[model samples]
Target: MPFYLEIIISVSLLTGGVFLLVGSYGLVRLPDIYMRLHSPTKASTLGITGVLIASMFFQSHLKGFLSIQELLITLFLFITAPVAANMIAKTALHHSNKPAEKTQNQALMDTIRDRESPPSNSIK
Candidate 1:
């Protein structure tokens, strides 16, 4: 392996590790469900993406050909993480879980309520 490739892999791994640590810390230390949900969904997605990129590069270097599995996993993770997070957040809202005291965003609250409530016009 060349020195540059090693450096790239090391940097990617280190960045991923750092983001994962931040996400885990946020999950443990954040005050409420909404705040806690952000770390794992956003930070961990980036973290996993970095690790996956490193894996892809490492595998390609070893095999002398590009690897598809890691790419697919990365794509899947990117697509699913946000959706899963949204669903979890909606579930929490449906159960009446409030955000932390310092968080006050009425527009977002109104949007969620609008989505949950029935349409104003209904056929009799």
Candidate 2:
């Protein structure tokens, strides 16, 4: 309703749109799976968070009360995005039948191998 609130919502929506676009572009243009994972996980999370914030602002301004659903969704997205990305990356590494040039990190390789193999010692 007010000029400043309208400006805030507009800016937030625009920023979210821009971040989402960048993430989409990265998914298409990046060379490898590992590189591609960074885009959607990081940028998209920020983008969604921004959009959700804008929604909360707009709704509160309209209804004269703060909305909780948008806050919850934003919180869920922030918590889950990185975890989902990690799982996808791990799955990719596991199923990569061919040696990928991009997967050169020795620590990651070691961690995946460790996860695959059974523990040597049993907890009696």
Candidate 3:
């Protein structure tokens, strides 16, 4: 309602919008599925968080209570975003069947796999 508060809300929304735009660009411009996730996971999260935090400021003064809806949404966003991204990547990996670039130590993996393999249960 106040002039200064209005300015603050406007600026906050602007910043959040900028972040959302950047994230959308990253989603479109990124080369690979893994890289594409940076757009929504990092950039969009910041954008939404910014907007929610700004909304809290705007609502608190009039309502006399800090609303938890925005806070809960932010929390859910943080929790779900990464899991969703991971599911996407994992599904891609499963469907593609092409091996990832073996940049890591193959020897290490071999050793670990040998250690972790289940013992042959049926002694045929």
Best by lDDT: 1
What is candidate 2's local distance difference test score? 0.84
lDDT of 2 by residue, 32-109 (tens): 787888899988888988899899999998789998889999889888888999898788778763444765674666
Model 1 alpha-carbon drift over 4 Å, by segment: 106-111, 114-124
Q: For model 1, give the 10-residue run with minimal summed lDDT.
A: 115-124
Q: What TM-score does candidate 3 reach?
A: 0.73
lDDT order of candidates, top first: 1, 2, 3
Local accuracy by lDDT, each model: 0.88, 0.84, 0.79
User: lDDT value for candidate 3?
Assistant: 0.79
List residue ranges in candidate 2 displaced over 4 A: 97-111, 114-124
Sorted on TM-score, highest at the top, how do the candidates line up? 1, 2, 3
lDDT at 36, model 1: 90
- On the 0 to 100 scale, the lDDT of residue 26 in model 2 is 90
User: Over the stretch 1-124, how does candidate 1's per-residue lDDT look in tens digits?
Assistant: 9999999999999999999999999999999988898998989888998899999999999999999899899899989998999999888877878778877794587577657455668635
Each candidate: RMSD to true structure? 3.2, 2.7, 5.6
